[model samples]
Target: MPEKQRYTLPTKAGDQRQLGELTGAACATLVAEIAERHVGPVVLIAPDMQNALRLHDEIRQFTDQMVMNLADWETLPYDSFSPHQEIISSRLSTLYQLPSMQRGVLIVPVNTLMQRVCPHSYLHGHALVMKKGQRLSRDALRAQLDSAGYRHVDQVMEHGEYATRGALLDLFPMGSEQPYRLDFFDDEIDSLRLFDADTQRTLEEVEVINLLPAHEFPTDKAAIELFRSQWRDTFEVKRDAEHVYQQVSKGTLPAGIEYWQPLFFSEPLPPLFSYFPANTLVVNTGSLETSAERFQADTLARFENRGVDPMRPLLPPEALWLRVDELFSELKRWPRLQLKTDHLPEKAANTNLGFQKLPDLAIQAQQKAPLDALRKFLESFSGPVIFSVESEGRREALGELLARIKIAPKRILRLDEAQDAGRYLMIGAAEHGFIDTQRNLALICESDLLGERVARRRQDSRRTINPDTLIRNLAELHVGQPVVHLEHGVGRYAGMTTLEAGGIKGEYLMLTYANDAKLYVPVSSLHLISRYAGGAEENAPLHKLGGDAWSRAGKKRRKKYAMWRRNCWIFMRNGRQKRDLPLSTTASITSYSATASRLKRRPIRHRRLTPY
Candidate 1:
């Protein structure tokens, strides 16, 4: 047996303690324990979004407390587009819940926490509560939705979109999982149904839904006035030619409008720290000071890079983001703990509580017993062990694996059902496993037993609009990527450019074909373009423009496809069968070739003498 590794964790968290020697899922375990014992809200600020999400998922297994992950916009500081609808919905939902949350676990990335969010009252004020029998007017609701930045679409397929048709009102509220169809009878709502966007079928019946604003900023007349007034005050420009000023004045919400959210608000937007209670305990991993500094640097870089877009003037980065020192000052308001996976820094506190991660299962490739180490650990471990897999299928598979190795284990659901000296299987996810020496409990995660897992690709929440636009917009396409043009063959995307044809300027996609041939396709015809996927792009054949090779290849492809569609049949018109006889075969004196040769020898004497 190898020497047992040990980590020092405090039994009770100090006002400002530095936790050291914690790695992988053990960090989540410690945070969960802190949340379980602490009376106030526990905030864990991770260095990045992925780490914060992993910790959030893992911590849920350890404690029954509410674990909320407030993610970032996943966009640049001065991007031309907004975040996805689902991401926006999630952020708004978390912001709405944060103020009322007395005690729970809130996990956030350092950058997310650094940005200022809309105040609680802003959302609460604009929100509308609808029930089964509420009196409503379609026109009034439509006007309100428009003011709230909700698009009046023909169908409510995404968040912050609403549609009205006669007595039925459909709206997908921000911060909601599903779109809702409100069936109204005359002036009152008769029924409310949550629906599936793809199938357009009602999934469940709901009595009430809280309608929050689509954008973080307001788009109403008053808010727009406030924004324009503030813009004049801030920029000191009147009747500016900026596209943002012109559009916002007309109450049209433009892309990447989040940068100007502060101007729309009557009061100053509040930081994330303000949402938490006075006694909120903050647990942070990694160097937040450095992260903040790096964020500020990236913000400045973006600010500089976006200077070319004269139509959309950017407010300074200081207005949008909190500085490193300001972030640190906010951290000072809460009881802080710095988590580390390596050796403690010089002169740190001497807090101690032993928590050891499960040792790696060392198995040789040619070894006879691959499960030998795991069997031994299960047999020797004194505390109850829980085998956590990523899902139910994994749980059952792991159960079978254990059973086949002559280690029968009980199947359980929750951690509370664990028993001393027993091995159990459960559905849970943890990056790694750990042994709590103080609690006499051991958790053997999938990673611990089977090694690293292949993470599943995240599926997009939004449904595909159409095949023509499988890629929603040209923004999805990048330079140097291969794309297929409907009329032309495969070409490499160069970039977007404005070309004037017949005295009119228009946007077009620049595609480079063979021999540096360029084809400028109209932006409106993006439907005819798609991303190419012919494996190993460097090896892909690029056909020359205005050449017959592409047409010939297309014809051949179409022919093969047509043949395959008809049961992949092969037309063997000249093929011979077992029952058929050849015409020139000399069999039973009925050979046509033999007779013809004989007649040819007789030639002119009796020309047509070859007869039956």
Candidate 2:
């Protein structure tokens, strides 16, 4: 790889410094520089979720250190539990990584930092790391799971649930992408494999798995008694309190109980700030004073509007969220750096940590002639230059563009090729690009040259495909909501209910149609049902049960889809034929003529064709 630009900033222990007017890439470079100088955990806070994610992506380009992103659970007024499983998993993973003392970077939004999390003691105690040959009785394993707040289910599908059958046990652990299947030979673990929840098939074998608690709160007997006692002390005898207390006493927790997790603990809950080491370097993208104030105001407004309802009791704002002043106080204990997108003032205060202004290295926007701009940039820059495109297609396009300008840039798959000083021009793929003027290198991105952002391709990761994955979470579904079935046009979703068929129990989705007709769809067929989203929910038309009209409409839609698929196949086949060129330069020109004639007879609309 090209040597990273080495720059120094005025940063000291127990000092707060403001970095002025650095772009996203510049900020990331600064963070990487600070990380190299310091030898501890680095926490970077952004103004919002979008900024946080963008900064994380930028920082990854500079360093290979363990970088974790903490996203907001959601912005809903009052949620018993966060609906986002990924965010919850990410938060837990970051917390788990923090205690290791391994150097890493954590990017998080200001709002996320304000929210309180489960105590560090609880998280450390509840986390389970099991390896092969870890001898433990089945009963003891069950008790461990119960203490970790996992619920026993008929089948292991979503996180926090487990199922046992004969000598086999399946568990969907928190912070895990897929559920694990343990084959026990009379309590001694025989084998373990990660399996797909939807197909109920093993994917791969593993020797060890680190499992985190599914929920934040404890669900054991003592935890229940503590919660009940706290609930009685907080609220007067009311219907909601009594109902929640009854459920907790019966060893079952109600939905949205996560909001009341603080009540379960006798001591005060801690914010994320408390978990960090004393030497951790805290970096703020913008003015922390401004962002924290806005976050606190927005949170207070949400709590004020929603905290008074008896039907949904909300945890007091002070208990669940930290004030701006309190957050600043906590941050003051660590060395803090503030990044701004504007120049610093002349007579600014807080000079304990001096300022180092980085040079402006923004790429000039391409005007009408992109080829001319590329040619000029290539000829003018003597140092190493890398052009980053988004995809293979863009790479080819850029190569063709450069070829027209008499420039033959070598296409390199890895950054190691650019380390050689002799190679000036190279092409590669990156999500975003920037120039490091200090290193005498420039990275021109496709977006900067073409003025069009490419859609990033998501990397495929192994995920547990449960029935819930096929549809919305059961908690999000409600009666009388409009739902659409592949066969049935549109109908109202009633609710989920259990039915027994052939002496085997299964859950099903109940849908209501016209004339009070009901259709019970097996949970396995969840992929066929979707929330009605054609138009306005109120204006959607419901179909009658067992109607011929629905079948006819479905057939017509299938026919159109099939035709579209055929067109896509033809386009792909033609493109492949073009790419399968002969290596010999003396190949017959007649073959090209024949291909051109065939193309003339069936003209290919390259622009209209979508990638397969």
Candidate 3:
């Protein structure tokens, strides 16, 4: 391992510097080193979302400071729903923390950087804080939540929602994972506790809670007036706008109203670059020009083919998003560092105040016996060696493999644990691994040592909403749209209505079928319903209610799907078998073992097998 190299940045704040030919991990390490010496926020701009997320994880290994990701909202033209709540909450939280935190890292994609967001002043005004001993009337609190865009519900199950039951109030605040149960003793607060939504069990008590607004747009009277005026002036009268306008006038927030965020403010929303302080350091992982161009082209293509009805009326692209040229102009205001894996352009290199070359430390191919290769590599190097595997079982197996080769490597659970050791081999868990020759460190992941297998990144330990439930919101349903029931064939969706059966009251989705037959499905069974999606809604066929014909059609569909799946599996299996044949010879037997090990290390990418 080579000694870690340190380069000096230019003296002036606005000067640009280039760090060329560095891999993702190497660039992250350099950023971490620079962050250690700096005193303020560090912004790392990746070319795309995947790279932004990957670099965020890599940078986390180097510093304990807050590392935040500002993800793209991913709004497409005529999208029926707002961006995911998690994505919105993360962006707002980062914005709120940027001005206050002593040091932090913000990773953002170019698309997110170009998108317009609410001004810092607007967000600061909406943020609310509560303490255990704080005194507040229930009526006042409820009104405040409603004005801040939180929905009142009978039960709190998701973020941006609150429920009140007598003296107890349950609320899941934005920018937080769990909901808080606030027990109030009349006007004075009694206690505050965080509870699990699944079990309704209290986890722990907290003294205070800081809450960010549930929606990005303000819901105050003045803001609503602004939205109403702008919306009426921008487009001709349409059914969708009229319906939304009525809801706004009545002080009710309609679903997917976030699409109209630009109208909520009287002044134009600012680009993300406006939030950063003047002295804050900016690092571009690749060329911003290329990223901006790609985003512009993709957006234009999506807008042209969206096929949304004109009456529904989407905001023009310019009103909601920034132009590529404008984003590039904003990029010029920051003191910048450019990290490039490939050769830098002559014009950029000449204009940069200083240039530093980072060594390339990529392993092109692995040898036949990885364990033997590892032993030899360790003997030839005098720096730290970290072997990262995905699971505890694999970590234990790796330790045994090393023991079989008469080598004892230290077991490290965290990166901080490896700081004191030099010329040591440590095993830990990581997503992907690489060797940093500049830091004299080699991070050999299970995949790289064994071969590429299907590896799925470990999901965070949070409850995930079902995919079918996320496809479309119930509010987005129209009276005449086609819908599909898992057990029944396609039917035309009638309006939802309250129904009482067996002395129980519930909301049901009414579906009309052939011969004017009707089927009422309980709202609790929403997971069983899906919007008919393959073709135009008008072309969908209506099924007869209580007919065996629908069952027969379902059976045929299942059989066809099973046959297609079987053929795909057989093709993949035969291809793998043919590829394995080359490693069967005596000269390549060790390579075959390495390949098999690699397959085991790779995360399984295949979907779960189901009985047809």
Candidate 4:
């Protein structure tokens, strides 16, 4: 059997507890252990001196040694560094090639020190890499974790994650995956393992690494250079500026060379370098709390405050049901408006109490009451009204009530068709009360109550209105009139015929066009079908068959249809004006003042702060 490699050595049980106390100190101890095992002086690199100090202090206590060369490395000098990129590049070249005094290690958090390392090529132990086709390649699976980056305890949790492209892969594997291997090949596998998300490992067997500093990892050099230059202008005067000038003056800095270190490396060296060991214990502080209930409660409270009740009608059931019945009675004229119901009541029930036959529906207990206000409203208004129903049962019940009340229904329209009908009185469900046209308020009545119909028809200032009735009237499509086809260009619809296919029969329209060509279209394709813009009646006798004029007319109609689809009806109401609705004078003044205060106090740049 092959030997098993041990990644974590067994530490005394108490050692684990001691490690927990110091987040930074624990990391130092881990790095020291690895350095001792490797018999090399480790170099610890950090973004700034403060980070270096914290790490250094922890390591010093563990090793009881002052190997931190505070003077030689940290105190280097630099000058004439116009662009920060140039200075950084010069320094890294010196550090990477500079032979180790004892055991050198670089501690660079993130790619700041290494720059421009393609995330795709970064590999860490048990880290996941995603390839093309959104596939993941995971190594070193911990059954409990099974995936990297997912169960990690780090804040802004990242690392041990990999994604793949057609032939490329990206992995942010942390310490577990050292010098993550990169596989490149032509329909074959070529592997190169180097990089640690924590900067722990480096190229083990590669001949040369075209490594750039952690900061240059991004593909855009200009952007990185710009940022680095800006950062330098602000804070670069410290160790980095000093080190560059000293190296350039001494002629120790290399020209045109950028040192790139593996993520697995302990440290990134430039102006300063210190020691770090492999397998350093790094603990991230902060907890991520999951509270779904809090979010749900907050959202519920907001809706409740707005008077939105999901389980019940926006208005009381008694008020809503009564108004609905009064509206349905007025739409029973058209044949197409016949209400379809499962079963009819043995006799008409006084669904609307103390009402008989349509118009007398005005005879309610009290006209001013909220439940009868709509009936009073209908009687007082001089304009025509159209009521549409969506549900069959409601339509039928409403039809019976309307019949019992003796109110004439002008039109029953499908919600989609009626919105554009341009009638004076248009009543329908407001589509979840959001005032959208997608929903239809339908009125249907049963068979015994033949007085109620599914739809009605009425004349309007612009055109005749009745959704159900209009649909039935559309049945009389003429040969010369323009008709739209789902696929074929606009042509004159000659006539309708039933075609038998596979023992099934379907009705289709025969359309003859300008070229003397004919096309067959099925009725099921109604959405794509529509009528041309010519009036219901034209001045001259309609021409037979097809011509250029019809095609041009069809195109014009299609364009208009597209524009119509984009149009939406909007009702604007300011709640301040709504207070005029019979509110007490004293209460109105208080409400207005409160509203004014709220408006004044609100921040101009008000931002919604999401609850945690």
TM-scores for all candidates: the values are: 0.73, 0.77, 0.75, 0.16
RMSD per prediction, one decimal? 18.5, 8.9, 6.9, 35.6
Model 3 accuracy (lDDT, Cα): 0.67
> What TM-score does candidate 3 reach?
0.75
Best by lDDT: 1
How many steric overlaps are in each model, in order?
Answer: 0, 3, 6, 95
**All candidates in order of lDDT, best leading:** 1, 3, 2, 4
- Model 3: how far is 165 from its true place, Å? 0.9
* Backbone clashes, candidate 4: 95
lDDT-better candidate, 1 vs 2: 1
- lDDT on C-alpha atoms for all candidate structures: 0.71, 0.65, 0.67, 0.31
Cα lDDT, model 1, residue 337: 77
Candidate 4 ranges with C-alpha deviation above 4 Å: 1-19, 23-30, 39-49, 57-90, 93-95, 98-102, 111-114, 117-612
Residue-level lDDT tens digits of model 2 in 1-612: 433323233346557666564542567756766666667888889887767766776566556677788656653535543444545665677777776655878888888898888888988888888888788688888889978878777766566778888888889888877799988888688888999876678888999989887676677778888887988888644555436566676777666666777877888789898788766888888766787888777777887887776655666777887888888777777877777766667434322222232222222211223246556766776766666654464466556555655876666654446654333333332334555544555566555543434433323321122222234346556788888776666899898888876544667899999998999987555556666666888998888998877888758988997797567546544544566533221122222222222221111111111111
